[model samples]
Target: HVVTARVVVIIVAAAMVVIATTPVRSMTVVILTVTPVTTLLRGECIELETLGESGGEAFCDRG
Candidate 1:
């Protein structure tokens, strides 16, 4: 029982460490991935606005 408890504690601690470390990396990856897409979309919206396309106003307003 004692040995099993110790092993369980170690495993839980290791899992906690991995859980803690994983999100920061993933958050950065998400932000990095999302930013370029938003920027590109915004740029496209601006171009559309300049060209006086009908639906361009809606996109720029959303951004």
Candidate 2:
């Protein structure tokens, strides 16, 4: 029982490490609906977005 539990724990830890270090490609749309006359943080933004597995090129519409 102890041996099986250890093996399972090792496998789970390995998977966690791999997932944490891996940069998985995914798709998501970022929409910025900010009024021309609004809050102080209305225009500028430091966005960190990701792309899909198909390739590069971020799908964003900053308007």
Candidate 3:
């Protein structure tokens, strides 16, 4: 009975940890996914700007 109770407690604690961290983990995932895209876009914009293209500002603004 004590072992069963311990097992139940461990399961509950693990579940609670998962539930609590889920949002944070998802946000981290989103940031990780988005950062590279944003960086790539920004790099493209900078390249365009360096090339003295008129559309560079517009492209960066749209991004």
What clash count does candidate 3 reach? 0
Task: Note the residue pairs that clash in candidate 2.
Answer: none
lDDT of 2 by residue, 4-60 (tens): 446546655655565566536211111111222122122212121232322112213
The whole-model lDDT of each prediction reads: 0.64, 0.33, 0.64
By TM-score, rank the candidates, best first.
1, 3, 2
Task: Give the winner by TM-score.
Answer: 1
The TM-score that candidate 3 achieves is 0.39
lDDT of 3 by residue, 1-63 (tens): 345446546655655566577866765655554576566657777877888888767868877
The sequence of per-residue lDDT tens digits that candidate 1 reaches over residues 1-63 is 345446546655655566577875756655554576566567677777888877867867977
Candidate 1 Cα deviation (angstroms), residue 63 = 1.3
lDDT (Cα, 0-100) at 38 in candidate 2 = 20
Clashes of each: 0, 0, 0
